[model samples]
Target: MSYCEDTIKKMLPKAYVRKHVAHEIYVAATHFKNLVPMMDKYVYNDGTTKDLMSLTGTIPVLFNDKTYNIPICLWIEESYPQTAPICYIRPTREMMIVRGKFISSNGEVEMPYLEEWKNGECDLVTLLQVMAVMFGDFPPVCIQPHSEPEQASCWLQFQRQAEVLSKTDGSFYVSLLREDDQPFQQDNETSC
Candidate 1:
């Protein structure tokens, strides 16, 4: 038994109807070797926290003829197969979350597979496979640009300008400036 298996056995002793939750996790590990299971405290949106079993690691996604390892975390509730595991895209320090149709700005994943999860039909392995496919179609994150000292200062200036512009109801300027902070060519005819 691996550490994850042991932890599952120890933490979930109630032996829920889906008594093979640990076994499912073990199978998923065999398929996605990079994923490692651990128990962690997961805080809910309502501010409640629960110690839950989670698998954290990267899943290989082939995009544009190249493979990228997309980091992810899956939180399995105590109910096991009765409920779908909560999933999130956990980008690395060099990456930034790209809010898309299937992913939220905060990195929470929402897809048809999770929304239509059925008790005996949905499993961790299949869930991961689906995520790989969906992510391949629309990546959940992108590599953020490395900022030099000068670039950082420029970004701060843009942020300050955006703040002032936002206060003055310059919604267009606020949106454009906050998007990427890229320097835009000033047109003499254009004024905020």
Candidate 2:
């Protein structure tokens, strides 16, 4: 049996056979298909290994009434169905967070849901929900346009990080994954 066929059997409904892919790696090339006609522009480029599944996408998140597309990734180990996927948000250069319990600039996540991840009982959408809550709390400290000489003492910085961590919780992450209808115009002259 070909590699593509084997991979599809193990991780189908997400991946299709593609000999033309770069390096001949078969990946689930599209976003989860409960999406719309035009698919609302999801920007995830992720795939699976023989015993692993990974997803990397810049998902749009709304916090404080503002939207930010954050780069996120998750790796589901071969031990899934009983374990959670290791997940994290790729930090942009303009952002930093020194005070997150389950978050870091290096994409290390210690979220509770992930610890409680269950195979056949959990999935990407559930993972997205956890991320939303994490983003809302720490929310990626923005880079300043100008440099300031204002120096913060260690105590002050530590205190700030602590404050941010205190409010962090594993809630409000999955609210963003919605299957809304996308506006599409059908060409009346063409048919599939």
- Candidate 1, pairs of clashing residues: none
Best by lDDT: 1
Off by over 4 Å in 1: 1-8, 11-18, 148-192
lDDT assessment of candidate 1: 0.72
lDDT for model 2, please.
Answer: 0.44
Tens digit per residue, CA lDDT, model 2, 64-105: 455566665565544444566566655555434333566654
Clash number for each model: 0, 3
lDDT of 1 by residue, 125-149 (tens): 9999999988766667654444535
| Every candidate's lDDT | 0.72, 0.44
Off by over 4 Å in 2: 1-52, 144-192
